[model samples]
Target chain A: AQSVAQPEDQVNVAEGNPLTVKCTYSVSGNPYLFWYVQYPNRGLQFLLKYITGDNLVKGSYGFEAEFNKSQTSFHLKKPSALVSDSALYFCAVRDLTSGNTPLVFGKGTRLSVIA
Target chain B: EAGVTQFPSHSVIEKGQTVTLRCDPISGHDNLYWYRRVMGKEIKFLLHFVKESKQDESGMPNNRFLAERTGGTYSTLKVQPAELEDSGVYFCASSNEWRTGELFFGEGSRLTVL
Candidate 1:
């Protein structure tokens, strides 16, 4: 079974400051990682995914994540934060063997970007 | 193109009452998935449907919950004798390609089992 763990329940960052939301995954084999964001009263929106490519994966809203194979981590990062960036973020993973399988998600981390 | 849409955006019912939620996937999307979020917890997968077939239902909580995707277009999930623990948001997502696995999601149906 593939699983994702996000240690932080909440993340706070000031405007113009960089922010990081941590996530670690455990999979039987190679994993397909994904990041999603959900705004208030809205559905989870696709941010980005890491299939098998460069360690740095960039996505919408100036967000990026570093995939560390050795550390078994894929931490979401943003060079600068905006008040509008405040939302709930989720990390998910699925084993490479089964692309059709459902993603195993981590407990979401609520991001609060302060102005 | 319209994204995934779920019916009964909010349903509040008493325990033991039956509630059925509906989801209509994006056109041409053959893969439909059901997931649930219990408050602040991670979203948990309930099942997956490939066309009209149940590809995987390993994550379904129990037999009390029944899901059917008839004719591979729209899916429905029926919960009988619901409990307080079942109060949460039920989300439906669809993906046209399995390899890419980028899913478009519905706003979700908020179910309250009182």
Candidate 2:
């Protein structure tokens, strides 16, 4: 089974400060990791994904994530936070070898950027 | 391009009643997926469809949950005798390329069973 764990239920950060939303995974085989964000009253929006490449992958809205194969972690990061960046973030993973198996998502982390 | 769209943005009903949710996938998209997010929980896969065929239905919870994509352009999920635990947000997604797995999602249909 492929699973993703996002330890923090909530993360608070000040505007202009760097922010990080942690995520870890467990999979029987290599995993495809992804990050998605949900704004108020909006659906889940794709942020970034890590398949197989340079550990660092950049995504939309100036967000990026580093894939650590050793620790089985793919943590989302941003250089600076903005008040509008506050939303619910979800980390998901799927076993690459599992064919069309669906993505397994974390419980999600709510981020609040205080201006 | 028009993204995936779901009908009945919100629905409130009594337990034991039936509810049907619909989704229209993007034009030219061959793959459509259904997912549900229970209150304060992770979004979970309910089923997947490739064209009009049921690609995978393993995630479907029970027999009461019925999904169909007759024309393959639009899909509908009908829950018979919906239970209180069935109340959740149902999200529909579509993708031409399921391999990369970057799915375009709909705003979701919020179901509330009292």
Candidate 3:
């Protein structure tokens, strides 16, 4: 079984400040990682994914994540934050070996970007 | 092209009632998925369908919840005898076979079991 863990329930950042949301996972083998954002009354939007690539992956809305193989971590980062960037973020992982398996998501982290 | 669309955006029903939610995937998309988020919990997968056939349904909670995608175009999820625990937001998503792993989600149907 595969599982994802987002240790933080909430993260606060000021406008123009950088922000980081941490996530870690436990899987049997190589993992497929993804990041998604959800706004109130909306569905989850795709952010970025890490299949087989360079450790640093850039995504929409000026966001990026680092996939640390040894640490089993994929942390979402942004150089600067805006009030509009505040939303619920989720980290998910799926086992590639299983072939098109469903993604397992971590409890989402609420991001509050202050003006 | 329009994204995945779900009907009856919000529905409130007493426990033991029935509710049906519909999802229309973007044209040409062959993979459709159903997921849900319980109060304050992570979004979880309920099932996946490739065209008209079900590919995976391991995440489905019980027989009370049923899903069907006729003709492989649109899908419907019917919950009979809804339980209080079933109150949550159900999301539907779709992606073309070529984009196998990437899923485009709908706004979701919020079901409140009173």
Candidate 4:
């Protein structure tokens, strides 16, 4: 079964400092990885996805993720964080081997960007 | 374009009561999906609908849960005699033909069973 693991329960960082949220996955075939953010009283919003090609994929709101195939990791990163960036981040993976399989999500890491 | 919308933002019901959640997918979206996030748990898939037909329902917890999409439009998920364990936030998502995997989610319906 394909699964995504977000090791950190929560990450705290100062505003304007760099931030990283770790994510690792296990899948039988090539993985379709994604990052989503959920704000208070809102639905999950798509941030980025890694389907193929580029190892580094850039996403909305100055976010980027590096897809390390050998490491089985897709870590979300931002050069400079803002207080508004604080939210719950989730890593998800889709099993490419299975036709149109539902995405499996991680437990989610709460990000706190202090001003 | 309007994103996916779910009705009754929050519902509090007693155990063994029936509850029905509604989701309206984006215009012209052929694929709709149902998911839920229980307290202290990761979001889990419940089912997928391709038009009015159910594509995959393997993730549904049990027979007490029933989902339907009539005429390939709006979808509804009904829980008969809900259990306390069923308290969670139910989310609905949709994607069009061009972007099959890129799902747009609704604000979700929060259900509380006591």
Candidate 5:
């Protein structure tokens, strides 16, 4: 089984400050990790994904995620946060070895960037 | 290009009623998928369609839910005699290729069963 865990229900960060939303995964085989953001009244927007290349993957809105294979973690980070960055973030994972399986998503974390 | 679209942005139905939800995938996209998120729960996959054919329906909760994609262009999910637990936000997504993990999602249909 492939699953993702987001420990924090909500994260608060100040504008222009760094922010992090932690994510961990459990998979039977190599994992394909993804991060998505859902804004109010909008569908989920793809942020980035980690398939097989560099551990540090940069995505939309100046966001980035670091995949740690040894720790089974892929934590999303942004060096400088903005008020518009506030939204619901979800971490998802799928087993690459499993043929065409659907993604398993986390419970999601609400991020609030205080201006 | 227009993104995936789902009809009836919001719907309120009485329990034991029948409801049909529709989804139109992005043009040129062959892979369409259905997922749902119940209150306080993570999003769960319901099924996957590849050009009007059911590739996978393992995630479907029960037989009360029926999905059909005719002409390989649009899809519909009908829930017969909906129960209270059937209330949730149903999301539809599409991808150009199966191997590509990136999926474009719709705004989703919010269903409330009383």
Candidate 6:
């Protein structure tokens, strides 16, 4: 069973400040990780993914994530936060067992950027 | 390119009634998927379709749920005798190919069963 976890239920940051949404995963095989953002009343938008590459992966909206294979963690980060960046963040994972298998998602974290 | 689209952005109905949700994947997409998120829960996979064929449906909850992609361009999911627990937001996604697991999602259909 592949599972992902977003340890924080909510993360608050001041605009222009750095932001981090932590994610960790457990998989039976090589991990396929992803990040998605959802605005109120809208569907989820893909942010980025980590298949097999350098530890750092860049994504949409000036966001990036660092994949720590040893730690089983892939944390999303941004150098500067914008008020408009406030939304719900989800972390997902997939593996070989996940042949066309649905992505296993985390409970989600609410990100609030204060101006 | 036009992204995945779902019909009936919102629906409200009474328990025991039936509801149908539709999804139109990208024009050239061969893989389509259905997902749902009940209140306070994470989004979950309901099923996956590859060109009018049922690729995998291990996530489907029960027989009350029926999904079809007859022409392989659009798909519909019908719920019979809807229950309160079935009230949730359903999302549809598609990908042009299987090698790239990146899925483009639609705005989703919000269903409320009272």
* Top model number, DockQ: 2
C-alpha local distance difference test of each model: 0.93, 0.94, 0.93, 0.94, 0.94, 0.91
| Candidate 3 off by > 4 Å | B98-100
lDDT of 5 by residue, B7-79 (tens): 9899999999999999999999999999999976788999999998999999999999999999999999999
Worst 10 residues of 6 chain A by lDDT: A94-103
Candidate 1 lDDT tens digits, B1-114: 898999999999999999999999999999999999999999999999999999999989998899999999999999997988899999999998755668888999999999
Better of 1 and 5 by lDDT: 5
Error of 1 at B66 (Å): 0.7
Candidate 6 per-residue C-alpha lDDT over B1-114 given as tens digits, one digit per residue, 9 for 90 to 100: 888889989999999999999999989899999999887677888998999999989888999999999889999999998999999999999987754578888999999999
Better by TM-score, candidate 3 or 2: 2
Candidate 4 TM-score over all chains jointly: 0.98
TM-score of 5: 0.98
User: What TM-score would every model get versus the actual structure?
Assistant: 0.98, 0.98, 0.97, 0.98, 0.98, 0.96
Q: Candidate 2, after superposition: displacement of residue B74 in Å?
A: 0.3
**Clash counts for the predictions, in order:** 0, 0, 0, 0, 0, 0
Look at candidate 5 and tell me the lDDT of residue A39.
100
Of the native A-B interface contacts, what share survives in model 1?
A: 0.78
The regions of model 2 sitting more than 4 angstroms off are: none
Quality of candidate 3 docking, DockQ: 0.64
Q: What TM-score results for chain B in every one of the models?
A: 0.98, 0.98, 0.96, 0.96, 0.98, 0.96
Spell out the clash pairs found in candidate 4.
none
CA displacement after TM-score superposition, residue A37 of candidate 4 (Å): 0.6
Q: RMSD to the native, candidate 3?
A: 1.2
Model 4 lDDT tens row, B1-114: 889999889999999999999999999999999999997689999999999999999999999999999999999999998999999999999988423368889999999999
- Per-residue lDDT tens digits for candidate 3, residues B1-114, read 899999989999999999999999989999999999998898999999999999999999999999999999999999999999999999999987623367889999999999
Global lDDT of model 2: 0.94
